[model samples]
Target: MKLIISYKLDSIENVIPEKQIEIIKLFSYSKSDFIVRKIIEACNLKHPNLEKIPAYNILKNNLNEIINNCLDSIAEKRLVNNQFDMAIIEVVIIDNGHTLIMKLKDNGIGLGENYLHKLSYPEFKHTKSQEHFKKKEKDYCIGGCGIGLFHLNAKLAKNDAKLYLKSRKEAGATIEISMKKPY
Candidate 1:
């Protein structure tokens, strides 16, 4: 029942088109802020205050949504005793000046085939199941609204970015976001 999060930020010169970067997964939820701060620093924004920057806010909010989704998926899988002792979330950020690519992988219960298909739509829909609602009360469900991904995609679209998601039931999920640098 431990959460291990890790991330790697590749330098612009070191980045290869399809090169696979290795990330050593270690750390906990409490250290997530440090990881994020490292990513912001890697962006090399000239602004004195990151919070006041639009791109910074967008990136931070998107990351938070993805991380929360991973946590929720892990929690649900844990309820069914389908998850391992350690839940890992590995993030890779590749910034090459023009483009910013973020890849987040999680060891958690993944989206079902039906649910994944539904995600293609542009409307609001509940991604959770009735069993989920019954087990975790509606008020207690952390991400029951199921609009996080929708909003994430909309925000990305506004910034001329794209989102790609891949998942296998009971295995895990990978969310990749490719956006232009500096929003």
Candidate 2:
């Protein structure tokens, strides 16, 4: 069986580069630590102010949305191909409490160097994911509004927090979120 995922990407294609830089810069100045439960909790909050203002407070209100949204996209695409699997979204603290890193992984479609071209530095904007879903493609999906990641990138756009992504063509994809120093 063959699968085709089709959608217009011109609008978002320009966002990758600018978004990448902003996200990394935001992470540069950290001083925040997010517990797994908070990550889960913040996902439910509709507001962008995920964390209350205070020193040493880890703010990641929309993390779950970002990860879950990505998963939803993955699942949608899989459905088109009649494939199924759980996309594990994990937040791992790599260094001491001073540094934070998150990993959103999926055993779905792996991103290649070619896919890298689509990345852009994120910015605050209104985006719609439904566009990526094309009726002509069964194994394809229109991801959530780009705002999820863009907000994440902008929110983390301090002190060099970096968002990295890796994809293995037929394997899947993994997104790494890391910040250099915490407040």
What lDDT is reached at residue 29 by model 2?
24
31-74 per-residue lDDT for model 1 (tens digits): 24545555556555533344544444676766655676776776
- Show the lowest summed lDDT stretch of 10 residues, model 1: 18-27
- Report how far off residue 49 is in candidate 1 (Å): 13
Off by over 4 Å in 1: 1-35, 45-56, 134-145
Question: In order, how many clashes per candidate?
Answer: 0, 34
Per-model TM-score, in order, reads 0.66, 0.51
TM-score for candidate 1, please give it: 0.66
Please report how far candidate 2 places residue 77 from its true position, in Å.
3.7
**Model 1 local distance difference test score:** 0.63
Give one digit per residue, the lDDT tens place, for model 2 in 1-183. 111222122243454476564442332222012223445444334323323322113235455465455455565456645554443444443434455455666565454456443444444343322344445675454444445555555455553566666766546666677765434
